[model samples]
Target: MSFKVWMMEIRVPYLLLPIILSIVGGALALYHGSFDVVNFFLFMAVLLLLHITVNTLNDYYDHKTGIDFHTKRTMFNGGTGILQKGLLEPQQVYRAAMGCFIIAAVIGAYVVYRVGLILLPLLILGMIFALFYTQIFARNMLGEISAGLGLGVLPIIGAFMVHGLPLTIDCVILSVAAGILTFNLLLLNEFPDVDADVPGGRRNIVISLGTKKAAKLYSLLTFSVYGILLIFTLMGVLPPLCLIGLATLPIAFKAASLSFTEPNVGDSFFQGQKANVQMILVTQLFVAVGIVASLLLI
Candidate 1:
């Protein structure tokens, strides 16, 4: 296949957004003199690569498990552009996913070399979790917990690798807060996919809790993230202005209310997917703004 064909099949451009956001977050943390620039950049690169690899793998597996078949017609969003669109064979998609994972492993190995053997196990576990998230095993049972640990704790490990031991409690708190925010994003995204996911045997939290309860869970997590920030500020850990994240509360509340009233109201999978994506992007923007404000004001 031509390069353009492959790119189109994988939706590679859309993948850049998350990679860029992650790099921005990591860079912002470093800009505040949190760690060595070189090491921080390397860590960011590793994460961005891993995230892209996971996205690719998800596309491949969603197709492998027949999730993409009905996605084209129903209220289900399709991934693995190749499989969904019939541009590439299943084996080809699988091979491409493995290639991305291999590249991520190389980057991870370097991180281990720079840090210590302690991070190796975490790295291996993370890779496995990434693969199994939508692949061979549906650990969707532990989705929230895994999301928190993988997104929150793992990034903090990356930060510490560059900064070294005797880690700052402040960073840890920020990391946990960031992780919670990330987890909520994932949770919200799953809302629209509940229908297709249930039939496909992908029963995640949304499937287990049902749409109404899951919507409430999303709302609770959204508010709780800012609430935790406020509490931290009261305790003098986070800056008071970090509560600027509350600025996005109106948007979040609107999304939550809509989600609760019409959990799966979109006309099609694409529309539903768009709604969930909007929530996640808006929340991330608020969190990013909050992070910047905290760094400056605190």
Candidate 2:
């Protein structure tokens, strides 16, 4: 496969999540006065590889189940359509997914070795989520929670742990906000996939609650992320500078407003998805920036 095909296969645009997630965790560690540049890079490598594994395995399983064949491929929802396009064999994608997981595990093991055994369970859980997310969790109601935990909460905690720091109260609070933000992202994206998901044996939040309620839930959770940040910042649990994350609120409101309307594969819904993505990335990026800026101001 050529470079572009490979990038498409792994959903390269979505890869930004792991990078931002790594920084969130790493910056929190830095704020606590425990940071190693080498370990931070290793943590990012593991996150990037595991994220690629999630993408490839999702495409492989979705293709095998014919979900990709039935769903409308969009910039956000649906798989990459690589398998359906005959660009890559299913087994090839499967192998690539497994390859990335094995490499991530090796690096994670090294992280554990350097950081102490505290990180072992989280590393193992991350591997499990990568391997079984599309096959198991998406079919049950656990998919959104799994995404929030694996992609959201745990990365921040693990990144903090790599600095040999114990779990602090502030870090846990910030991590939950990350998880909720990610939960909203997955919930919003599921709107267009409800029809295909029902027949595909998937029972995610949108499938369980119906799109109307799910969209409401999406909007509620999206704003609640800022609410959490604001409450904690005011309580002095988070740096007051973390309120910079709320700067994305206008974009978030537009995204949430659009979610209430029909969210089919139309231009309006696409804009909503695009806005949601921007909100997720920019909010997390600003939060990390705020934490680091607090350190400098001190």
List the candidates' TM-scores in order: 0.81, 0.98
Candidate 1 residue lDDT tens string, 133-245: 66544444776666666655566545554544444555566667667666765676676666667677786777788878987787787777667767886797654555665
**Candidate 2: regions farther than 4 A off:** none
In order of listing, the candidates' clash counts read 1, 0
In order, the Cα lDDT scores of the candidates are 0.62, 0.90
| Clash list (residue pairs), candidate 1 | 75-269
lDDT for model 1 comes to 0.62
Residue 285 in candidate 2, Cα distance off native in Å: 0.4
Give the TM-score comparing model 2 with the true structure, all chains together: 0.98
Backbone clashes in candidate 1 total 1
Worst 10 residues of 1 by lDDT: 72-81
> What does candidate 1 score on TM?
0.81
